[model samples]
Target: MPIELKMPALSPTMEEGTLAKWLVKEGDSVSSGDLLAEIETDKATMEFEAVDEGVITKLLVAEGTDGVKVGTVIAVIAGEDDDSASAPKTAPAAPKAEVAAPPPPAAAPVASTPAPAPATASGDERIKASPLARRIAAERAVDLSQISGSGPNGRIVKQDVEAAIGGASAAPAAPPAASAPQAAPAPKPAPVAAIETDIPHEVVKLSNMRKTIARRLTESKQQVPHIYLTVDVRLDALLKLRSELNASLESRGVKLSVNDMLVKALALSLIQVPKCNVSFAGDTMLQYSRADISVAVSVPTGLITPIVKGADSKTLSVISTEISELAGRAKEGKLQPHEYQGGTASISNMGMMGIKQFEAVINPPQGMILAIGAGEKRPYIVDDALAIATVMSATGSFDHRAIDGADGAELMKVFKELVEKPLGLVA
Candidate 1:
């Protein structure tokens, strides 16, 4: 019997995912746990591992095709040695599977004649419009060729149409329509001022991750009462330790970064404050024994948060290595959902970008998120004497509904202790 490869649920909030790429093509032999397709969920691009040993008979969902709901048939695998030459080729042709695939995009409308265009000033000349404008006009049922162009290329601009249709520059408006319905209707107003314009914009569809982020963040802001607690930690010793460690390990290929140390410190802090390592269920908060910290990475499409599992148990070196790998993959959009999700908490660090401090939205299910800032030289009063010190400010955004202000304060204190004394984190 053949088995279906349904779109795996990548994140708790993922409803559908994009088929980013397929590691195994049709007819390729696959084994249980074998790497299959690379799926792009709402958060990250992740590997879709096979669960059954068989041959990839067909791919119902092709690469770049998206909006596949969770558990929908993404591919089909035939039993060992079974020929799959007759399997369906496209999603539309696939037999009924567990989860239903979305209907195909509607066909383009056929025109009886070539699309009508605005009359250009030149005889028999067609309107000069940007490609995007042309497409937008088609979609909005606007007659682009009819509008006059004010652009350098004599192209029809959005404002041009608005101007043609009673913009500020439009001729003096005629009397009210009710009063002058019989008289010639007033000419459309043109823009009064020379309105500055930009190149027509393009509308790119949102990726799964962006859509989910928008939806979840919007909901979090609307539903979760968020409270922020901030603390500036003096990182003189940590920076000095990191420099020494990097110098010693230069040959061993283990140079450490402030962000890496921060990740390690956050992990250790979680151990002391396990309450911070929890997710809010409807009535109660569920805590986890292990500390997995998801670090946010920015990509071309949007942000991806890849988790460093067992972070508390891992040494600084291990954490650094895993974090580098995960970050690289995140930029390439190659992370698996598990690699990005399943974290008890998250860290959004913008220190490298010279950000002094910032707050981050809480990635759902998780009760806490730490926003990191850049290290800077500042004056500090030590023992009544003012001295310059390098300190990095960090803010923890807690779900007030789950974590109390005192608890948040305690967690920040623990984090300060571990990071200020870098040895504690490594030891």
Candidate 2:
């Protein structure tokens, strides 16, 4: 049998991706784990590998094809012993009888559900559930093993898990079902007004990265209740410490940036005020023990946050080196999924760009993000007298649903203290 190679979901949030390039062509012999293609997701370009030894029969999707949906057949691979000439040249269509099969068969019995459950429930074995279905199951604590698949070849899918959940909930003491009155239909939204222009302009299509960014940020602003807290922190002491450390560390080729110090300070601050280092999960709050800071780096495509894991415990030099490497790879779109996926908190520094204070949208799951502005010479109170000092406005955007105003303030206070003190970050 010829096996169909579908577009793999490179990331958890990936629904579709561009077929950037094909490394193998029809009639090419390949072994398991051989590089098959390069797929460009919303975040980065990832290499897809062959799962079975086979001879490529046909390429269904051409290179550079955008928005190829996940699970859409991209190519066909015939078995090692199979003749390539006899392999299917296209995706095999289902028979009319199979297409006409009724939905009642899927709901037949709970025993049928177990047929697909073994693939996922076999201890420590990889599950063959769809990404969305897996996420839904995780969030609902519904065991994947108990659900029967209704998708292709007994593959567990979203509808199957949902149906299983509904069945289970209904199994508990059946309530007298009453037909509730249907609410009035919602009114259609007003169409967006088109912009009038006399000058000729090009209609540039948005890239996958830009589209994902737009969608995620819009959702963050709309769904997350954000509370912004700004504080002016004197950076003179931190700057002095950085210079001194750089001079001493010059022999080792290690130079620390202010952003590196900021990452450390934020991590320690989160450690001091654990309430601020949290994620807003519906009906629950996730309090993290380690402070992993996602530092925002602007790539050509868009912005990406590569995380600095355990920043609180790492030395400033280590944080500086790791961030440098991560940011470089991030800009090149070479970061792996794990490098930019999850973080306890985030820090977005536009200080180097010389931007003044500006509020940032909160990244979902993360409760807070520290936005750092340029440090400029300004009037400061020293011993009750006005003096010159380098001051920078740092704003902390918090998810009000997850972090209280007081806790957010406390985290900011601690951050300022660590930065001004300049020794706690290194110690």
Using lDDT as the measure, which candidate wins? 2
The backbone clash count of each candidate, in order, is 18, 1
Tens-digit lDDT track of model 1 for 184-249:
222323334744559786667888767766766776676668989999999899989998888987
Q: Each prediction's TM-score against the native?
A: 0.66, 0.77
CA error at residue 319 for candidate 2, angstroms: 0.6
Task: Give the Cα-based TM-score of candidate 1 against the true structure.
Answer: 0.66
Which digits, one per residue and each the tens of the lDDT, describe model 2 over residues 1-427?
Answer: 7877766655534566888999998889986556888899888887776656789888877788786766666788889777677776445443222222342222213222223343655552355566667777889998887775544345566555665665453321111011100121123334448888989998777778888788778767777799999999999999999999999989989999999999999999999999998776666666777888899999988999988888888999999999999999998888766567667789999988899798999877678999999999999997799999999999999999989999999999999999999998878
Candidate 2: count the clashes.
Answer: 1
| Top candidate by TM-score | 2
Q: Which ranges of candidate 2 are over 4 A from the true structure?
A: 89-198
